[model samples]
Target chain A: MNRYVKLVNFELGRFMKVYIALIGITIISQLAAVIVVSKSYLNNANQAMNVDHMAIETFIEQYGRMSFNDVTNSIFFIGPIALCIVTLLIYSLFIWYRDWFGKNTFIYRLLMLPTARLNVYLAKASAIFLFVLGLVGLQILLLPLERMILQWMVPIDLRWDLSINEMIRNFDRLGIMLPYSIAEFAIHYGIGFMAVIVLFTIIMFERCYRLKGILLGIGYGALALIVFFLPVFVQEFMLYNYFYPEELFMLMLVTGLLVTAGSIWMSNHLLTRKIRV
Target chain B: MIEVKDITKKFGRKQVLRGVTFTAAKGEITCLIGINGVGKTTILNAIMALTPINSGQILIDGAKINKKSYEKITFIPDAITMLPQMTIGQSMQFMQDFYESWNQERATELLGFFKLKPEEKISSLSKGNTAKVNLLLGLALDVDYLLMDEPFSGIDIFSREQIAEVFTSHLVEDRGVIITTHEINDIEHLIDQVILLDDGIVVKAFNSEEIRENEGKSVVDVMREVYQQ
Candidate 1:
C-alpha cells in the first residue's frame, strides 16, 4: 500500500499541470451545459404560462415546423466528456514517454517498473476514479450557482433540488431502505467501473499475440454475461429477493474477486514480466 | 552473481542470440561489445529477463529470474521512450514511488550533477542529457545487478565521461553492471570483463586485462578483429 501510494503520488506530481488544465476545461464545459439547459427551460416556461400567447405560439410554431438538425449541438454536449478522455490520454502518453528509465517504448518502460505490475495498473485506475469523483463533486457544488445564473438570464422562478435527495424523500413513504440501496448501487457500479478500466489497462499492456488478447477479452465478456444473470440465477435458485442483502453482498464479492484476480494477473504476469517481443 | 548458460533467442526465423554462455560476479562491470545486428542488446535483454530466451535459462545469484525476481535486478536500456511529456521531477516521483530500491537522494544529486533541473521536461532535454538521466537511474537503484544496454552509444564525449564516472563511482561491493556498447573507449579502463558477441553468439568472453595482454590491443581493436570488420 505504501509503495503504491508513493508511486501514484509521484505520477500525479509529475503531471500536475496537465491535470489542472483538464479540470479547468471540464468546469468551463459543464458551465456551458448549465447555461444551455437554463435557456431552454425558460423558453418552455414562457409558452406554458401563456405570458405572450401570440408571440410564444409564433416562435413555437416556427421552431416546431423547422427540422432541428442538432448534430453540431449534440457534438457540443460531448465537449466535457470528450475533454476528460482526451486530456487523460495526452497526460498518460506524456508520462509514459518521458519517464526516467532508458527504454525504447512507453509500454516496455512501464512493464519494467520494479513494483508489482498490478500497482501500476491500480494507480492509473485510481486516478480515473478520483478524476470522476472530483468532477461529480464540483457539479454538485456548482449546481446552485447554475440556478442563480439561470434566474439572472431568464424571468422564471429559479429553483434547484438535489436530484438524489429529492428522490430519497419521494421514496421515504415506502420505507425501502433507500440509503442501503444507494450504498449497494455505489459498491456495485464502482467495482464494475474499475473492472472495466482494469480490463483496458491489461489489454494495453498485454504482450501476448493479438489473438491472445482478443481471447482474453472474449473470456472476460463471457464472464460478464454470467454475472449479468446473477439476479435471475438467484431468483431461480431460491425465491424472490430471499436473502436479498446476502445475495447482493455475494454478487459484489464475486465481481470484486474476479476484478482483483484479473488485476493481479495483468500486473504480475503480463504487465511486468511479459516480453516486449 | 549472474549466469547464462546455452541461452538463445530467435525473432521469427532470424536468431538474435545463439547458444550464449557467460557469467558475472558481484561488483563487476562487464562490457558486451559486438558489430551491429550481432545481438549484443538481445543478450542484455535476456539477462535482464526483459526478453525471454527461446532455449536456455538465466540464473541471477543462483536463482532463475522469472516473473517473481524483478527486485534482484534493474535494467537500463538505451533510448528511453516511456513517458515523454513529464518533466524530470515527475519521472523522479514515479521512480521514487514504484521501486523499493529507489535512491531518491542519489537521483536528486545526479540530477544536479547532470545539470538537469526538475522543471525541464525530458522531451526537451538533449539526447546527451537523456542518456545522462538514464545512467542516473541505473546508478541510483540499490540493486544487486544493473544491466545497461549501450549506455553511451549515442551520447557525446563530455556526457560519456560523466556517465563513465558515475558508473564507476556507483560500483560498490556486491553490485554488478553489464553494459553493451560499441564505444569501448568510454569504459575500457573501468570495464571488469569484456564479452564480445558475433552473430548472436559469444565469440569471446574474458577479463578486460587478459584481452589487453593476450591480443596486445585496445578493446575496440579486439572487437574489430573479432567481428572481422
Candidate 2:
C-alpha cells in the first residue's frame, strides 16, 4: 500500500457521506423523471384517442412518440446531474479549505505526515477525480434501468424506444459525459484532470501566503489558462491557419502537458518549502 | 541535539523572530518562557518546520528538517490537530496510518493515564480532556525530539498537574523536549534549561540547576530580574 494510495482512501472516506448522498439523489431523481414523463405521455395519448374522438394513428401523428430524450430534457433529470457537477466543482475547493477552516486545524497534521507533502496535494486531486468518475459511471449504469421504466410505462404503439447508445447520443449533455469514442473520452477527461491539477496549484498558492497568496493564485491560474490556449491563439492569429488540424492538435497537447507539469512543479515547491500551517 | 541558529521570521511588516538561537540536547527538557505573543510558539513552529523562517538554520543532529525529520521529531500544537468529528480511537488510528513513529502501546497507556475513552468524540471532550488527548498524541510518538506549544495554557489545575506528571514519567525520559509556556510554577523544577524570550529574541538562556546552585535563583527569580530590568 503506497502512502499516496492510503492518502487517497483517507480523503475519499472523509467525503463518503456526501458522495453517497449525491449518488442517491442522481438515481432517485433520474428514475422519477422517467416515470413522470412516461405517465404524462400516456395520458396525452389516451385523451387524444378517447376524448377527442381521434384514431390511435392520428394521435401518434400529432404528439410524436415519446422517447428517453423527453425525460433527459426535463429538470428532474438535468437538475440532478447539474447539481452533481456543481457540487464536485465546489468540493474541489472545499476539500482544501476545509482542512484549514474546519473545527480544528487538521492542516498541521497533514503537513506533518512522514511523506512527501506533494502526496497530500496529489491525493486530494485524486479523490476529486474519483468522485467525478464515480458519478459518470453511475449515470452509465442508470441509463438502462431508466429505459426499462420508461418501456414499462408507455404503450408499445405510442412510444419511441431507443437503445442505450441512441439515448446517450441523442442527449447533448450525456454525449459530452459519455463520448461517442474512446479517444474523445480520453481527451475530454485528460483536459478535466489537468484543470483539477491547475486548480490545486492555485489552492496551494493561497494556502502558502494567505491574502497575498490569493492574488498570486488567481494570477497563476490565469497564466496557466493562457499558456494552455496559446497554441490555438497562435494557430488562429499569428499562423493564419498555417498548421494542419492534426498539427494544431499536437501543439495543443504539448502546451497542455507543459502547463500541467508546470503547475505540479510549482505546487510541489510551495508544499515542501513555502507552505505554512 | 536540535540547534535553531539565528532564525528570523516576519509576518508582513511585523517581525516575530529576530536572530533567535538556542539548542536542546537529546535528554534535556528545554522550556521556552515568554509572555503572551512573544514568539515562543513561533520558535517551536519553526523547529518543526510548520512555519517558514525568513532567515535561519534549524538542524536536528546537524541535519536539516525534511519529511524524514517528522519521523524523528514531532510537534504538539496548542490546539488539537485532528478533526473534531473524529473519535479518540479514530484520531489514534489516523496517527498510526501516517507516522511510522506512532507507538500504539504508549498511546493506549496514555489513554488510561488520562482516563479517556477511545469511543469518545473529540468535539465532545472537555477543555482539560482535550488538552490531555493533544498531549497524548504527541507523547505516544517514538521520536527523539518533541516540541510542545503552550501545553498548559487554559486547563484546569488537576489536568495541569496530570500533564506535568508526564515530564517525570518514562514517556519523555531520554528524549529532547522543548515546551512553551508563560506559567512555570507547576514545572519549575522539572525543566533542565530555560530560554527567556522577549521582543522576539533570546534575552537569557541557562540551565536551571546551574542558575540555582551558583546564583541561588529559582527560574522565577531570574525571570523577575531580567523582565523587571
Candidate 3:
C-alpha cells in the first residue's frame, strides 16, 4: 500500500500490545464492577429486612433504588475508565519517546525512510487518534451490555433504568465521550484532535532540541493554548456580547483549523530540519 | 557520489563537527578513520541528513539531499535501528515496505551469508550478530551509496571477519561506501581512500593505495606522524 498507510500500520503495530491490554482491562473490570456493586446493594437490602427484622417497606423507604449513577460510580465501573484514559495519556508521550530514548535508535530508520518526513508525524498522530476512538467506541458498545447485566442482577422496582442517551446527557464525562448530537460530537472530537496535534507538536519541539527544548516546548504549548482559546476570550471580554453562540463556534472552528495547520507545518519543519537522531 | 562540503553541527554548546569536508565517489570505499568521539559518526549522520547540520551542505550525485536522494542512499547505523522486539524478518519487511529499492533477494542472501535466522529477535542476537543484521539491512538495499557508522566497533572476532569479508564479496559491488571507525586495522586493506579526522577537522583525505605506494608508509604510520606532531 501507500507509505502513509504503511507508517500508520507500523505505528499501530508498535502500540497494539498495550492497547489490547487496556481494552481487556476495561471490559473485565467494568463487568466485575457492575456485578460487585449490584450484589452489595442486594446484601444491604437483605441485612436490613431479614437480619434486623425491619419491614421490606421500611427498607425500601430508607434505601433509595440503585440507579445508573450508582452503577457507574462504583470503583469497578469508573475506575477502569479512568485507568484507561490515564494510561492512554502516558502512552501518547511514550510513543514519541520510545523511538529516541529506547534501547535501539528506531528513529534513524524512520527518518531515513524515502517518504516525506511528515508522513511519520501524521502517522503517529493518526495512531493516537485511532486508539482514542477505539476506546470510546468500546465504551459506547459496553453501555447496553452493562445495562442488561444491571437488569439481570437488580430487581425492576429497586433499580432505576436509564437509556444510554439519557445517561450520557446526565453524566459529564460520558457526555464528553459520547456527545449528544452531530454538531456536539464534531466540537468535542475536534477539540480532542486538536489537543493531540498540539501535543505531538510540543513533543517534536522537545525531540528536536533536548534539555533546553523542554522549556521551549512548554512555552510553545502555552502559546498554542492561548491561540486556541483566543476567540472565546474575545467573545466574552473584548467583544462584549457581540457574537452569538453559533458565531463563536464558527470562530473557534476557524481557529482550530489554523492551529492544526500551523502545528502540522511546524512539526514537519522540526522533523525534517532540526530533529537529531 | 556523496559530497559533504564544510558541514558544521553542534549539540547545544559543544561543537561536534567543525567545517568538515569530504567526498565518497561511486564504486569506492572511503574510510573515515579517527579516535573515539571525534565526530566521525556525526559526519556520517550529517551526510545522510539523519541529524541537522548547523551550516554547510551535503550533496548526493551533485544534488542536495532530499526525500528522493534517500532512495539512492542507505545508512546502516552503528547502533541497532530496528526495535529490540522485532524479529530479523519483521525488520526486513519493514524496510521492504517503505523503500521501493529494497531487494528481498539480497536480504535473503545476506541473511544466509551472515548465518542469521530470520525469526530471531534483535534483542536476542549477540553484538556481532546484531552488527551483521545491521549490515545485512544496508547491503540488501539496492542503493548507489551506503553510509555505515562503525560497522566493526565492538564485535567478536568472527563477526568482524564475516563483515570484513563482505567488502570483497559481490554483495557490495558497485556501491559507494562511507564507513566511520576509530579501529582502522579491521578494514585497512579493504578501503580505497582514507580520511583522517582530528578534533572535528579533516586533517587528511587521500587515496589509501597512493599513500601506501608513494609515501611508503601504512595509514597507521601516517596517523602516528600526524597525530603525534
Which is the leading candidate under lDDT?
Answer: 2
**Share of real contacts kept by model 1?**
0.52
**lDDT string, candidate 2, B13-36, tens digits:** 999999999999999999999898
Which whole-number lDDT from 0 to 100 does residue A154 have in model 2? 85
Q: Residue-wise lDDT of candidate 1 within B1-229, one digit each (tens)?
A: 8888999887767988889999988888887787688888788777766666789878898987653455568778787634677777877776766667788888888888888888888788899998877677666777888888787887788988887777656443458878888767767898889888887788988887877788687777777777775
Off by over 4 Å in 1: A13-22, A36-113, A151-180, A201-205, A210-256, A259-263, A275-277, B65-72, B89-119, B165-174, B214-225
**Candidate 1 structure quality by residue, lDDT tens digits, A88-171:** 656443443344234445555565666566676677656655655565566446545654554566543233333444433443
Worst window of 10 by summed lDDT in candidate 3 chain A = A66-75
lDDT, candidate 1, at B77: 74
What C-alpha lDDT, on a 0 to 100 scale, does residue A208 get in candidate 1? 45
Q: Candidate 1, residue B195: CA error in Å?
A: 1.6
- Best-to-worst lDDT order: 2, 3, 1
Q: Which candidate number has the best TM-score?
A: 2
Residue A71's lDDT in candidate 2: 97
**Which pairs of residues collide in model 3?**
none
TM-score of chain B of 1: 0.92
What are the per-residue Cα lDDT tens digits for candidate 3 across A1-277?
8999999998999889988999999999989988989999999988987899878778778898887788777778888889888987888898888898867989898889998999988998889889999999999999999889989999987888998898777777788889989898888888988998899989989888877778888998888888888899997889888988888889889989888899989999998888888
Candidate 3 Cα outliers beyond 4 Å, as residue runs: A52-57
The predicted structure with the larger DockQ, 1 or 3, is 3
Docking quality band of candidate 3, CAPRI definitions: high
Off by over 4 Å in 2: none
